[model samples]
Target: MSTEDIDVMVYDYTVAHGAIPAPLNFMGFPKSCCTSVNEEVCHGIPDKSVILKSGDIINVDVSTIYKGYYSDASRMFMIGKVDKKKQDLVAITKECLRIGIEAAKPWAFMGNIGAAIGNYAHKRGYSVVREFGGHGVGVEFHEEPFVCHVGKKNTGMLLVPGMIFTIEPMINMGKKDIYVDAANDWTALTIDGMPSAQWEHTVLITEKGAVSLTY
Candidate 1:
């Protein structure tokens, strides 16, 4: 499904379960979903004021609680007819995520996933944002197994079956520097104001491979 569809589904689940209670107040976020469009790196709160346009790329980040378990996922989307440059960026970014998942086999180190993602990003002349990385998710909103998008091979936590986490790679069209908009306090932007894209999935490491729970 499209990122927007996934985003709406997540929000529906959240509202159905009443999971948007205390955290909504605790985090001080204006909305339950984060719909960040082009030039918005992350945490762009969804609002009627910001309507998506054709050729615009957006990231829909969703976090929700279900059956006492929490799940988080995000995906990139092209509002309409995206140009070749943006299309390539989205394609490669998705590939980088796939590559990272491929490295999440049993007995594999978390660093392997990072190496795979970084290597693909580097090869494509893109840069990965290291400021924010993936983390384990289950009962809590965030958990163990910090998954960085850039690292050396055979390092960090080892993957084991039944382990659930996320591997979200935020890629930039230009430099890797990112800045949070002071005015909004929620939106993150690329330092150069260039476009950025991100894709994420809550994955469970199994004996076969990573199973995407939010897919």
Candidate 2:
């Protein structure tokens, strides 16, 4: 489906549930959802100008505001007849997200989240995007305690119960450097023109372990 169609679908769904798309009006963002394909990294604008093709891997990011609360998440989708390398990138990117979440625990340092994800991605010959990691979100669209996807363990903020945030890792098959498209100034593209994949979920820190609010 076109990105515009996806945006409408999400907008309607949110309204049906007495909610709203958080990105719809925030910071002048034009779409209800973000659709990033292939080399595109994040904040891609939904437009009728672009169309999905076979073998393409697309990342659909969705965030919703409901009852003064917010939840954010994203997932990758492979079009028909994808290559093994691209397929593996998607799978590994998801695994990176899982690894980060697994490391989030009470009293643990926030840096552990990125260290776990970064180490795994590096070991697999992939680079994690350090420019944009994750952030706290709940009553607002974006908040404090920026979560980095690349850092040293036992550093940064100390994890505590009742903290809400997201762990979204953007993994690149090529170099981690990225550039924003000048035309729109929103879509971020990998500099090497190689494939990139990302996975995200909002989570809540609990006394026991991390609970995925957007799972």
Candidate 3:
């Protein structure tokens, strides 16, 4: 199916539930959601011409706004019969998100999230994309505290209770370099033409620990 199909489905679901697809028209982003395939990193505009094929991996980023609140999440999908290397990349990237979330504890520095995710991905022969990471989400689409997925622990802003943000790590199979598509000026792709994967989860830092608000 094409990325547009996913967009339409997301639009329909959001409307049916009396919620809005947060990404639609946010900062002039036209789609209801983002679908980044293979080398495409993030902010990939959903298009009818872009079709999915076997051995391809795609990231479907979905965001919702309901009752003046927001939530965001994304997951990687392998079409069929993906190569071993691509499979490993997806697995490693998912683990990056997991570790990133695991490191988000109350009173801990925001850099702890990046430190855990970056080190884990690096050790596994993967590079974390630094151009875009997670962000604060709740009362607004994109808020303060830009979450970076590469930094040292015990540094950056301290994570206090009742704070919420996203933990998305874009991992590349090749080098960490990336560039935005000039034609659309939205879709980001790997500079070396290698595959990339990403996973996102909105986290809420509670008095006990950081909990995933969008899972």
Candidate 4:
């Protein structure tokens, strides 16, 4: 489906549940959902002119505010006929998110989450984007705790039960550097122009473990 089509779908789905799309009119954002394709790292501006094609990897980020609380999540899509290399990137990128979430147990340091994700990504010859990692969410669209995807272990804030946040690691097939589009300032592109994939889920720290709020 086209980006605009997906945006409308998101709007209708959210409204059906009496919730509003958080990204719509959020800080002047025009769309209800974000559709990032290929080298576009994040915050992609949806346009009807852009259509999905075979072998293309796309990330769709959705955020909604329901009843006074917020939830955010994203997933990567491998367009028809995706190659093995790209498929591996998507798989590993998802594993990175899982590792980070698993590291967010009670009494754990925030940096442990990043370290686990970064180490695994590096071992697989992928680089994690540092410009945008993750953030707390619930009362507001974005909050504290500032979850980083790459950092030294045992640093940052300690994870405590009841804290909610997102763990999205943007893995790049090339260098980790990125540049913002001068024309839009919102779309982020890889400096090396290689494919990037990301997965996100709003998580809540609990006594047992991290639970995904957007699941």
> How much lDDT does candidate 2 score?
0.93
Q: Which parts of model 4 have CA positions greater than 4 angstroms off?
A: none
Query: Tens-digit lDDT track for model 4 on 91-200?
Result: 99999999999999999899999999999999999999999989999889999978899988999898999999999999999999999999977899999999999999
**Which pairs, if any, clash in model 2?**
none
Report the number of the highest-lDDT candidate. 3
**Candidate 1 global CA lDDT score:** 0.83
| Model 1 TM | 0.90
Model 3 alpha-carbon drift over 4 Å, by segment: none
Candidate 1 or 2, higher TM-score? 2
The local lDDT score (0 to 100) that residue 148 gets in candidate 1 is 95
Error of 1 at 116 (Å): 0.2
- Backbone clashes for every candidate come to 0, 0, 0, 0
The C-alpha RMSD in Å for every predicted model, in order, reads: 3.1, 0.8, 0.7, 0.8
What are the models' TM-scores?
Answer: 0.90, 0.98, 0.98, 0.98
**Model 1 segments more than 4 A misplaced:** 1-13, 17-23
Query: Per-residue CA lDDT of candidate 1, range 78-183, in tens?
Result: 8779999999998898998888888889888999999999998998899889988899998887789889999999998888999999999999999999988899
Identify the superior model by lDDT, candidate 2 or candidate 3: 3
The reply for model 2, stretches above 4 Å from the true place, is none
